[model samples]
Target chain A: MATTACFMIVSRNDIPIYEAEVGTAPKKEDAAHQHQFILHAALDIVQDLAWTTSAMFLKAIDRFNDLAVSVYFIHTRLMLLHDSRNDDGIKTFFQEVHELYIKILLNPLYLPGSRITSSQFDTKVRALARKYL
Target chain B: MAPVAPRSGDVIFASVERVNAELFTLTYGAIVRQLITDLEEVEEVNKQLDQMGYNIGIRLIDEFLAKSNVSRCVDFKETAEVIAKVGFKMFLGVTASVTNWDAEGTCCSLILEDNPLVDFVELPDTCQGLYYCNILSGVVRGALEMVSMKTEVTWLRDMLRGDDAFELQVKLLKQVPEEYPYKDDE
Candidate 1:
């Protein structure tokens, strides 16, 4: 498990649909903003690198000092920033959340390429974070 | 020979020829998107989707009966169960649970935790009033009507609207008795 981790689901239209800060360590006031800033900053690199290869899981693509940014690609981009390095756990987390994302998408009322505001999706993602992250 | 027993939903679904889940999901998403663009109103889009489903249901019921080999269901309770159990399975490849029945057994909720229809959907604020799955209800109503059972179907719980599961309340409004072993039109 990572001492600290931030996860986000970036939609196809380049917006964060769902986000969660799942770190065991107590969070600082500026931590979430910094984490989000770092994650967004790495998107250009991730996107550029992702286009070159079809591989979905690109582990530790960028590092911001002590924290590392990892990413997994499906129709949407699943990105994570964490202090601890646990490749297997993060991959499992992405895969499981992807399944949940699919469930969210199948809802006819839910429009694709929109923000995922479902609290149920939020709760499940957090629970998965606790179990995996 | 006696009527062949209705095949289980699981068996029929497994045998059905279908495309990959992603293709099906994307195609539906495309249709809904096109409707929203063309209709320019969430309510209108919803109504059109329901109408489309109703049309499909009236025609699709025959395929459902033939494929599942379900005999005529006399009671509403039995009908709801078969729909939740077998109809949903053969068509969508997922089984739904029947719950929240009233004392009269004329109404019940079809709870679906998993269905192929809901995947990759997120509702915007403007589309809040939309019943995205309203088509399912229309389909149910239209199909039931064909069997001489006038019914009303509605969404009691919508996962897209932040509920736990998709719950459809199917209420029997009236039942029309069929004239059995009848003569053909002259």
Candidate 2:
């Protein structure tokens, strides 16, 4: 069975603004909360690496056995977790998401560091996942 | 005051470099769409745009000063001229005309003939209260505030809203004196 990809958008304040799961990875009981815990735990490693490197794309920053985590940071943090080792696919997905993220920032009503609850934004993210993830 | 030379804008712009317009436009488009979806009220959106622009402006001035190699202006009029001729040209690759001065000569308008940020953009009916170019006003306000000038920057007209042209009215409210909190005990 193919492992599913977990995508998360964490705000500057460390709150997860958007979260989605794509692909058919066999689900285990309590996997949702487990994924959240894994993502949050990885944040500490991400923070430590950020001070040492200037690259926006931090590939394979951490891993737990078969699980690999990729991190991208702009004004906020984008984290991707997957079992596969396709670095190129992960980079492309982050690029498209970054473009969408900047567009959201342009809205007069949308402030930085706030939760993104727009359905339109959610739809666009799903489409990108289908195309790339 | 007498009008400055027309080609000054051209001279300043020619010396300045350029960036890919697509990156600028697409980024701006995404921001506008996001703002519409997140904020339900138009008035709130307007205020937010100004606030955001102010933030951008504050930092942008530092870059403008470093790259343009221009000195400080003696008065508000000169400040207006530099912003129109140099600041806009350097950043946006376009020069706005400084016009419509008030009687006290402390207020003026920067009339923009073209704005690259709103290229291929049309205001949807649902976004009636949206000020598409409000960030520009905020930028000006924020940049000026950083220079110790307290100015009220407002939009007089916006082509994105179907106005005849794009105009930003900048008024010099008062000069804020720089307060030095740390002083040696004498």
Candidate 3:
């Protein structure tokens, strides 16, 4: 049994949109069946964040790109669900992400590349997952 | 750009600016759409819209600050000038001028030289709501409050009245929150 919880907060609306999953996986395999669920879950999280506020919606464009890369980096063998093979400027996007990551770390309110693990937000996400998928 | 047809009290050469129009339309759409969905009473919808616009005004002050890189206005006239020039020009693409400033200073008139939103659309005779214009009032009140001014916004003409020109009444009152968070401690 493997359970992972993740959560995100929207700054403008002060609302938390979350998604979590609890399922049994034989192992974290390359292109594993459970990994598909995780990718789907992450996409749902990104989509909800987009809908929360106008500011958040604009911010999500950048965050979604970063998250796609992060997921790939975390599971080197798993291709991202949203990866576009034809999407040009992959290298430039990565460079920009690296610069932004540095900026995020410099910000007192945030830490660089830290996975969001707010328990309250995760609880809401898990409840939604249980209800829907 | 060609000069817009001037209203009775409007500032000459009222011009449109893209940034202001984008911010205004987006904010107006967001507030109106939300009110129509989440609220039931017309009065409550109005209240919520005003309040939302107030907060938006507070945030927009920051935006104006960042974009214009200007310090606080020295007085209400200066404040009004910014509202006429930078504020409206930034958001609505129109410049309004003060006319017939009241002795109490609580009542002033704004003549619109041109209005993009009003162009090509006629307000039905039955219509009563202020709609997009109230948001501008909220922005003015909130932004001015940062520099210590208390004001109320009222309309002098209903574009719904089928008038070629538009005007709004701005009533300025005694200052509130005379100092800001960063103000020097006396």
User: Residue by residue across B119-146, what tens digits does model 2's lDDT show?
Assistant: 6565545677778888899999999999
Please identify model 3 stretches exceeding 4 Å from their true place: A1-133, B1-34, B69-72, B104-106, B118-127, B177-186
Model 2 ranges with Cα > 4 A deviation:
A1-133, B1-17
- Tell me the TM-score of each prediction against the true structure: 0.64, 0.55, 0.44
DockQ of each: 0.31, 0.04, 0.01
Candidate 1 regions with alpha-carbon error over 4 angstroms: A1-133, B1-26, B64-86, B94-114, B119-128, B159-167, B175-186
Local accuracy of candidate 1 as per-residue lDDT tens digits, B1-186:
556545358888888787898788778777887888889899898899889888989998998877887777757888998998888888887889999999999999999998566676777677788787787888888888889989988888998788999999999998888866767873
| Ranking, TM-score, top scorer first | 1, 2, 3
**Across residues A31-111, which tens digit of lDDT does each residue of candidate 1 receive?**
648988999999999889988988899899999999999999987899999987778888899899989988877766566
Compose the digit string of candidate 3's lDDT tens values, residues B78-134: 566667766666656567777877665557777776765543232222223535455
Error of 2 at A29 (Å): 60
For candidate 1, give the lDDT of residue A56. 92
Chain A TM per prediction: 0.93, 0.91, 0.27
**Clashes (candidate 2):** 5
